[model samples]
Target: MKGTMVALGGGGFSMSEDGASALDDYILAMTKRPRPRICFIPTASGDADTYSERFEAAFRDRADTSVLSLFCHEPWGYSDPAMLLEQDVIYVGGGSTANLLAIWRLHGLPEMLEKALDSGTVLAGISAGMNCWFESSSTDSYGPLAPLDDGLGLIPGSACPHYLSEPRRRESYQHWVATGALADGFAVDDYAAVVWRDGAFVEAVAEQRDRPVFWVERTADGVVEREIPVRLLGQ
Candidate 1:
């Protein structure tokens, strides 16, 4: 079965405060299941309680929400990675991309996520969550924006989230792609998400108007970039 993944640059149920719930609403609709089982993975922030609590509050009444914490200490080797594969949707939160990758690798979550995807789970996330899906991405893991070459590679190219929020993000991603430091990839503005189905680009979605996703690649002449139109949701 073909599965879907929505990689959000920023702005979602947990981040937006202007009564803007469009992106999260879209995620819910994507599940195509009543009371869909949605799991939140917050390992990026060291499985911090506050982040998980924010997630729970945002999704509490919207779906059947649960959190899978990988770093809990209290005989808390309690979570089964297998549970991740059972959900209808998996949402990852933003944080240190490098640390997240390292921890996920330690727990074999990358493999489990792939299995979950194959089972038609709708995977989604913002920032670090978005970066994890690509072959590589521009990240702030090293204190300044830099290219991260190893990713889950579920998507075939690189990606940059928070393209608009972070001033250096666009330039860094473009330079990396142009210098052969990173493969050709996509980038998205805040509040925007690039959607993929069966690992193919479908379209971009945004909670706000005019937020676009870009395709960037190295060209003989220089780096080439173009905006991919985004469909505004929750209008």
Candidate 2:
């Protein structure tokens, strides 16, 4: 069976002031189980305590939540990589994409995550979390926006998050694709997310109606960006 993934451009619990969002609720609802086992992987943020704490607080009443911290190895964190397989949803946090990839590779998390996905664990994340699954992505991990081709490749092509909220993201990504620096890919504005099942895009969703998602591709003339219709959540 194919796995399910929710890749958010932004606007999840982390970005929300109250640590709640329609996007997050949508993710939880995907599990189709009361009190789904949810694990927060904060490797991207260096396993920051606040991030985990916020995650726990956000999902506390809705799901069985635990955090997997790679830096401090807290008692509540998932130490055994195999434990990830038991989660109903593995939610990754946003941070330095490059560093997240490095640490995850060192800990053999890539393999473990694949296993978790195969076991029907819903994979979800924002920003770097969203970028990791694609073959390439536009990221600020290197201090400046650049193309990162070394991604998990769970999804084909490339991706760019914070497309609308971040300055120059759209232009830079379009230039990269047009110049053959990055593969044809999707770009999502903050407050928007794309859903995939069996590695194929199922739909685009958003917490805000104004935010949008785009499919960017290199054409003979130049780069073309087609806006993907978004389903506004909580409607």
Candidate 3:
């Protein structure tokens, strides 16, 4: 079953109320099928118990959503599309960016992921999942898994999450521009999300403005910051 990919600005496993669209949209899209196979991928890290727990909590028991935990650490998360072809949604959990990318490549998951998504298999990622889809990643992901020199390019720009959740995140985001690392990026706060539709940044949804998301572009000199408005409630 082919579907769309929804890359969220925040991790939905824990704080799930806001990003329900990622799941709901997938569910609603399957019109002619009994239900699409829904799998939650946690392989970016090795914590199966916690990953499964969070996945179950976010969705509880649903006839349509089956709880499947995938760990990229096993060196086969990316290589096994046969295990994923029946899945309607591949929801990636957050973890170390470098480790996530490494495992995906080691298991040959990036190419598989791209094929799955291209065929209409819905791909939804949070945090590390979101980071892996873009053309590049932030240095922030370096702390946990080492910065990824390569990434799966479902998205054409860089992805930076936990925007206002951290102290001096503006400084951190700006540093990318100052140092000429990645030019265009989407900086999403913990409560926000940036949706890509037909290969473009289409929607930005948030819960507050204090922690808003950003869309950046690179120029010859430095990166230019553009504060994209999010349709957050009461903002």
Candidate 4:
């Protein structure tokens, strides 16, 4: 089955007291399944219990929620990694993109997640989670903001999250792409997400007010950018 993947620039049900339900709701709708099984993969934050708890509390009523804690070595009742296939959606939490990829490799989760996605699981995440699906991304994982061109390659090109919220993120991503250090690709501000359905670009959606989703590329003149109009949920 052709699967869907939604990469969030930032903001999610797990991140705020007011709770951004738009993105979370859109993610659930993408499952196209009644009472979808949603699993939270919090490896980025080193599988922090607080992050997992936030996910559970936020999604408890929306879907059958569970946490996959790789650091704790707890399987969350499933004996094998293959059980990931049973999930309808896997939501990755934000943190260090480099570290998250390392741990996932160590646990052999990359292959498993690939399989899950191929079998129709909607793979989605925020920040680092957003950055991991592409060929590369701009990240703060290694102290100073830098380019991480070694991603899972599930999607072509690069990605940048918190594009507007963080002052350095915009310039760093643009500069990296301009210098050929990072591939030209998409970048979304916090609370915005770019959605893909059946491997095709769908639309940019936002939980808060409409924010621009940028397509950045190098040109003969210089680095160029075009804003992709966003559709705010509930508008």
Off by over 4 Å in 4: 73-79
RMSD of 2: 1.2
Task: Using TM-score, rank the candidates from best to worst.
Answer: 2, 1, 4, 3
Which should have the higher lDDT, number 3 or number 4? 4
How close to the true structure is residue 124 of candidate 4, measured as C-alpha lDDT?
97
Which one wins by TM-score: 2 or 3? 2
TM-score of model 2 vs. true structure: 0.97
For each candidate in the order shown, give its overall lDDT on alpha carbons: 0.87, 0.92, 0.63, 0.87
Worst 10-residue lDDT window for candidate 2 reads 72-81
Cα lDDT tens digits for candidate 1, 1-235 = 2579999999897676633478988888887877889998888888877777777778777688888888873323449889998899999999999999999999899999999999989999999999999889899988999999889989988999998788888888888999999999888999899999986889898988878889997999979999888888854
lDDT of 4 by residue, 18-87 (tens): 5547899989988788899998888888887777777888888768987887776444532356768899
TM-score of 4: 0.95
lDDT per residue as tens, model 2, 202-234: 999999889999999999999999999999999
Model 2, position 160, has a per-residue lDDT of 99
For residue 167, model 2's alpha carbon misses the true position, in angstroms, by 1.1
Q: What clash pairs does model 1 have?
A: none
Cα error of candidate 1 at position 147, Å: 0.6
TM-score of each: 0.95, 0.97, 0.78, 0.95
